[model samples]
Target: MTRESGRYKGKRVIQGGRAQVRTVLYMAMMSAMQCNPVFKATFRHLVKAGKPKKVAIIACVRKMVVILNSMLRDGVMWDANTAKN
Candidate 1:
């Protein structure tokens, strides 16, 4: 409750308990890069094509949100290895 009571509740932060959201997003992206073949390949391709690493990370984050939304709406479990838009 305390964490969510602050002015930045439900927002991204670099500090405080509320920072978990950003941390989790970052971790999810990193995890996908490590274990999700499709994401890994996409990220590598992006980087190789001269897209900055940071830009690629942001792309992965956006993709994660879209994938999550699709899976939730469709009532499906995610298969990161084979999942590609």
Candidate 2:
């Protein structure tokens, strides 16, 4: 277990996006992990698969970013079915 041991780990969202944007996204992901059906399920799945909590949260954040990008690009509204797809 030679992995760097510390309170900090991994690069922040997309290697240099706006700080405010990342902060807002991080907050949203945290809330989503607790309340949003889609993200809550994803977080639980990742943790069940042996990922650490922080790691799972980051993964959710990335998933959210991709979902947001795709929706924006396609000019679609948020849909529960779309989260599954």
Best by lDDT: 2
Against the true structure, candidate 2 has what lDDT?
A: 0.84
For candidate 1, write residues 1-85 as lDDT tens digits: 3334557646432345556786798789999899888889889989999998877886888788888898899999978554775
Per-residue lDDT tens digits for candidate 2, residues 1-85, read 1334476586543455577977898899998888889999999999999998888888899999999999999999999788865
| Poorest lDDT segment (10 consecutive residues) of candidate 1 | 9-18
By summed lDDT, which 10 consecutive residues of candidate 2 come out lowest?
Answer: 1-10
lDDT of each: 0.78, 0.84
After superposition, the stretches of candidate 1 with alpha carbons farther than 4 Å from their true spots are 1-19, 80-82
* Count of backbone collisions in candidate 1: 0
Clashing pairs in model 2, backbone N/Cα/C closer than 3 A: none
In model 1, the Cα lDDT at residue 53 comes to 87
TM-score leader: 2
